[model samples]
Target: MKPTLLAVAHGTRSAAGQRQIRDLVAAVARRRPELDVRLSYVDVQQPRIGDVVPAVRDAVVVPLLLSAGYHVRVDIANAVEGTGIPVTGTLGPDEVLLRSLTRNLPAADAVVLAAAGSSDPAWRESTHEMASKLQAHVAYASGSAPKVADVVADLRRRGARRIAIAAYLLADGLFYRTLHRAGADSVTPPLCLDPTVAGLVLRRYESALLTTAAGRL
Candidate 1:
């Protein structure tokens, strides 16, 4: 049997957020009809990762997260432990994701990438790297310094005629909506349900399977 791909997301209460995740999963299904694609959540939703992982005898878990942090490192890593199931890295710091973000971006004199911040320096560093690649500023929605509003304001103060926010988020949720109020000229939508993202999902799944096969050989 082909290995199942478990697309795990950090769930949210917003209805839009739920819809985005469902649509994203559907896109993945469309891309790889040969594989069984399933959805599960790490938090704030039903059918948690722990419950979902055990049901599948052979699987690869791909986190629908921008960066590897608590959920990806601790929660997901533990969920598949002792099961011999492979888990792919989080879906950011990649050109595929950057393509989606840039495609959806609105016109502006300057753009800022806003993320759900983390205390981990590595996560922040990765986000910064992506920002540098995109030629955009980096700020956090929460959890760290130089918050979204501050970043937006500073860009404007520095004489940026128009400021835009590219939400570096997976789905529509509280953080997605909150980007608009960050005082930017415009805030793009979350990086969700795009063909590029679906492609990235398949790429991660295929690469992990290849690595696992090599290890066993």
Candidate 2:
């Protein structure tokens, strides 16, 4: 049986948003040619997650979503629950991602770990440790007291020589745009259709489908 690999994305209205998901699909296809590769959005896009999952005969759902927020914990979960596909964790904020984020900072007096926040405390809380551990400044794009702007302000207050903002976004779009305007000396590139990220998706795909649950089919 060819285990399907669903590369699910949180969709957007921007042309770039759809394009990003397609680019991601192409990248995932390169690594795992044998598996069925499918793309779908969670909102404001075609082929919603509900529609995307059924197309895959049997598969593991990989939420391209950044954090385990209401979307992953509730929205996405409710969507795929009975489908019998084990969902993997969100792709960003992982240890591997920090490598790319830190690479953006050639030298940083402080850093803002910016993300598209969610009201879900679990999601928000998940990022705190990583942000604090970095030893640079930290903040979010969506929620909490020290937003990106405030974070940069706090850093400047401390007289940071250079401030580098790293986006926790899955693709290039509004969140990245907002993070830039939030007052920073510089920002890491928006996570785009990169090979490494695609590779990570493929890794999740392998583990999801090869495990006994996926094998039970």
Candidate 3:
């Protein structure tokens, strides 16, 4: 049986967000036709993690996220229920991701990282890592005090000649477009359904299965 590549996302009500997840799955399917490719959401969507894991009881689960958090460790945990399929890590701020951010953002400009803030400390730290990598001033919408606009204004106060807000996102969906039109200065193209990301997913799954196999010894 082929080990499945379950692409999980933090679900949203926006149809665009849901579509992004689907598109990512399609990209991965194209890159690695070997694995059983599928997608599931954490909330407000069908095929919850609980539902996706059982379907591929023998496949490794990989969160289509940039950082490890409750979804990767907790929600995904509950879904797998000790099925023995090694779970992979989140996909974000990777080498290509860093390149994407650097290439997208203008040099010498203050960057304001806009991410879907979370209550979890780990996730917050992960976001910080993503923001820091790009040499951008990090700001969160849900957890931190300053919104995207607030951060942009703060940069101006800091004597930034140009404030280029880079969306550290993986898709051209709501967060990307909404934050893109925020009138900061210029928001670069978001991480669309690209082959680089698909490769990351496939490699992560392979690593998970290898790790699971090693643990047996």
Best by lDDT: 1
Clashing pairs for model 1 are none
- Which scores greater on TM-score, model 2 or model 3? 2
Each model's number of backbone clashes? 0, 0, 0
lDDT per residue as tens, model 3, 59-138 = 77788887777787778888877687667878865777777666777765677878766777887788888777777777
**Each model's lDDT:** 0.87, 0.74, 0.74
> How high a TM-score does candidate 3 get?
0.89
Roughly what TM-score does model 1 have, to 2 decimal places? 0.95
What is the C-alpha lDDT profile of model 2 across 1-217, one tens digit per residue?
7777776788776677668768878888877778878877677777878777766777878888767776777667887888777888777566667676776666777777887766677777767766765555557676565678987887788888788887767777776788779888887775655557787787776676578455677
TM-score sort, best first: 1, 2, 3
Candidate 2 RMSD to the correct structure:
2.2
Q: What value does the lDDT take at residue 143 in candidate 3?
A: 51
